[model samples]
Target: MSVRAAELPSRDALQQLVRAKAGTAKVHHLVPVHPALAPLLPDGGLRPGAAYSVTGGALLLTLLAEPSAAGSWCGVVGVPELGAEAARSAGVALDRIALVPQPGERWLSVVAALAEVLPVVAVRPAGRVRDADAARLAARLRERSCVLLVCGDWPRVEARLAVDEARWEGLGEGHGYLSGRDVVVSVATRSTATPRHVRLVLPDATGRLSAKAPGTGPVELRAVG
Candidate 1:
């Protein structure tokens, strides 16, 4: 049998009901986009069944591979500009990732349908993502235990993670093979509590993003213009 969470007395009660109904569970470790975001999340990870907004859709899609590195199903919709090389840099295993080619109003429908099978679904909230649609999507995600990562400006999501341009001070690379060396990027996010932010040196290796350095101070990142 199934029960609506709205009817539960409280969140704790709902959790208990879910736990009892859903038998044993296995722990899945979460890889935070940055160390600064670790504490913001209850278990140093993205909470399942909620929405996380990435400031830049491209960057967000790349970073998403971190948590789902264990062969989990990931879906991206309404984004056709994704590059294979960029996907590699963001640590996504392109071979396993599904890129659904949907445009216009069909994107939202694709997102809703794909969420049933994909563990983590990322999308650009540009076309067809209305407030009512977001509400329905959130409910479906919660019911299905699918994590929805929205990459754009959407006000109805459960949480928001915004990224800004990286700050580099006194860092230089000579005109050689080291031209792309030592670049840093910073991202800031707002939650129910205080705002959280962090900066990290871009990963030297392709197809991966390093976890934030522990106890590192956050550099202020204003929105990208």
Candidate 2:
């Protein structure tokens, strides 16, 4: 008996299943991640065929900003709340950043499609991403020399960038508007035996990422009556 098309499964579902059954392959060549994050990575950047999980929602914009400014096309899927102003402020070239905020039930298909054209694609999985699907995406990424930045959890990731601690520098006991923040970044990779880490200000008072360690000196925050 023949099964109905709806029962057969969609293209995304098949890809995920196929990936789960596929074997791993080696990928060479790395793309420059954000300048601040580069030093923390063993390869100093993202590998074409690997997946990465990162904490800090704001970090998504900052991380993509790097390659985007360098003329690489970038896309964001599944993060509807991400704002254009924030992305622009973070150094992402507005013209090169593609935003798909919502893709409904076709999130995976959308990601797959973007991966084909964009060199960098940042996606926050709307739901649990099966290992099979993740693997398929990774394999595709490697083939296309693309960087897949996953905002949420994914199976068998190459590395994970997590924020251990974050404290604002401009907050006062009674006054001052929010200014800069100091954050500690922890890095872990499945391929490496050990992990790397760093501490820096994502956006200091000047509204720019500090290339070096964060400033320690305390400063007064403006008070308004």
Candidate 3:
């Protein structure tokens, strides 16, 4: 199935459907992440019922890949530029993912409704979020044991991940095409005073994430306009 913007469901309808489908299955405390990204997380995986602030679309896709592959439902809200091909290439199971490209004034409601059934939901707020609204959502997430990945700022988050540096490879003398990106990702948790950094091939030549090998020699990089 393709990942495309879907029509929003009514809150009552969505809740009833979720209740019917959810049954009484228990949710795991953590969701699996890419092996390369395990070390960066405080729990070695994404903790259920918690919020994480993430920067970069690639990184968000990376986070969803493992969970979706494991048969978990995922959703993305308010990201109109989310490329379906890129998501597929990044290993996301498009059949199990929902895309809400534009939530407009109902962004929060859409996210909340999705959280009822989706184990993992990502959203880029369309406007500034009020602290009270965030707090209410946080409570709902905890109650449902759902994981929320916010692309933009949140009033509170279990952890924050940001790409500190990035460089593309596979170009030589302006001849070869861009193939992969190497990035320095910084992970910060509320419990830690300083953030931890990890270098990774965000998307290697094969379009999958991997830890950057140690002691790799640096090559001259040309700035791209």
TM-score winner among the candidates? 3
Alpha-carbon RMSD to native, per candidate? 9.0, 11.2, 14.2
lDDT of 2 by residue, 1-225 (tens): 788877778899889877655423322346676777888886788777677887776677777877887789998898888877767777889998888988988899899999988888888888998888888988788777778888888888879988778898766677676677888778998867777778878776755567676665457656989
lDDT of model 2 at position 39: 80
Best by lDDT: 3
Candidate 3 per-residue C-alpha lDDT over 85-198 given as tens digits, one digit per residue, 9 for 90 to 100 = 878888999999999998999999999999988999999999899999999999889778889999998999999999888888777685777678879989999988899998
RMSD (Cα, Å) of model 3:
14.2
Q: Return the TM-score for candidate 3, rounded to 2 decimals.
A: 0.82
TM-score list, all predictions = 0.68, 0.80, 0.82
lDDT for model 2, on a 0 to 1 scale?
A: 0.79
Off by over 4 Å in 3: 1-28, 212-225
Clashing pairs in 1: 88-207, 91-207
Give the alpha-carbon lDDT of every model: 0.61, 0.79, 0.87
Ranking by lDDT: 3, 2, 1
Q: Which candidate model has the greater lDDT, 1 or 3?
A: 3
What's the lDDT for residue 221 in model 2? 56
